[model samples]
Target chain A: SQQGEEDPQALSIQEGENATMNCSYKTSINNLQWYRQNSGRGLVHLILIRSNEREKHSGRLRVTLDTSKKSSSLLITASRAADTASYFCATGVANSGGYQKVTFGTGTKLQVIP
Target chain B: EAGVAQSPRYKIIEKRQSVAFWCNPISGHATLYWYQQILGQGPKLLIQFQNNGVVDDSQLPKDRFSAERLKGVDSTLKIQPAKLEDSAVYLCASSPPVNSPNEKLFFGSGTQLSVL
Candidate 1:
């Protein structure tokens, strides 16, 4: 079972436009991570925000986390056509035996039209 | 640094057929994972290995699915009598010991399986 659920099953936008996706989780987590997966490709780690962090940024990507609401959002500014891919939010929970179990969300498919 | 490697980019089989997929994680990584991803859904963890030992396999369907990590470097997952529902992309990911919450995971391209 997935621990997180991403809002907006899919999104489409023109090139140079911004894209925003949201994720919500049910349980407390040690951290939350966002990943990108191109068609027929494996997931690529984008950014990670610790539970204590409220916001994080990487290049044109910005991430915000709200522990109180158990939600997180990812924003890509001036998105390019290459940014088209499926975005997923994974929650990292500290499981027994000193291992971190990261559970993924259903994912948000994004399309950037040129 | 070399990334995780998986073999047989694609596979097609009929019901009840047996098949296996291989994975070689990044060198020196201590943790390895296998996830099954159906189209349009997120990847689901099937098993996890920590240095040749099974850390978790709670989600694995032991009746037909089995995996083994030998010498703590390479792993293989096998399915006997595959079902159509078993068709999905099998992904291999590796990570170093997770002492912190900010650790990153390295993933392979994954094997696309089709069970008819």
Candidate 2:
């Protein structure tokens, strides 16, 4: 089963706007990571936040994690036309086997109109 | 560095036919994974391998699907008697040892399979 579920299946915004997407997971995790995917390319890792961290930022990307609520959000500031892509959240949990197991969420499709 | 590599960008096969996908992970990456992504759904992990050993494969449909990573470098996934619902993108990813925290996966372009 998918551990993470992202909210807002699709969003269309003009360039220079801000885009926010939320994700909720069912299980405890060690960390959560965000990824972006263009139409036909592989997913690119964006940022990762550990369970002990509350928030993190990378350039125009800001991510917040709330472990108690088992949720996370990604905020893209000043979104550009090139920012149009599908964003996914992946939860990392260390399994009994001592390996980190990653499960991805249904993604949010953001279309930035130029 | 070269990213993970996958072969056969796309394939179309009739139901019940056999198909195979190959992957070559980034150099020195000890952990590899195979995931299946259906239309509109997130990638579902089918198997995970750590240095030529299987770490997890609970989600893999063993009855028809099987995978192997020999010498811990490259891996292959094969499906016999593919089902129509099995049409999806087969993605291969590699990362540093899972013991290392916060390691991000490097993905291949993926093999798009279409079962008619």
Interface RMSD of each: 1.2, 1.6
Query: Compared with the true structure, what per-residue lDDT tens digits does model 1 show for residues B1-116?
Result: 88899989999999999999999999988789999999989999999998899988999999999999999999999999899999999999988766654377889999999999
Model 2 lDDT on a 0 to 1 scale: 0.92
Kindly provide the TM-score of model 1 when superposed on the true structure, using C-alpha atoms. Answer: 0.96
TM-score of each candidate?
Answer: 0.96, 0.96
| TM-score of chain B taken alone, candidate 2 | 0.96
Q: Candidate 1's residue-wise lDDT over A1-114, tens digit each?
A: 999999998999999999999999999998899999999569999999989899999999999999999999999999999999999999987656666788899999999999
Alpha carbon lDDT of residue A103, candidate 2?
A: 91
User: Given candidate 2, what's the lDDT at residue A12?
Assistant: 97
lDDT of 1: 0.92
What lDDT tens digits, residue by residue, belong to model 2 across residues B1-116? 99999998999999999999999999988889999999888899999998899988999999999999999999999999899999999999998755475488899999999999
Q: How well does candidate 2 score on lDDT at residue B63? A: 98
Chain B superposition TM-score per model: 0.96, 0.96
DockQ of candidate 1, scored on C-alphas against the true complex (2 decimals): 0.70
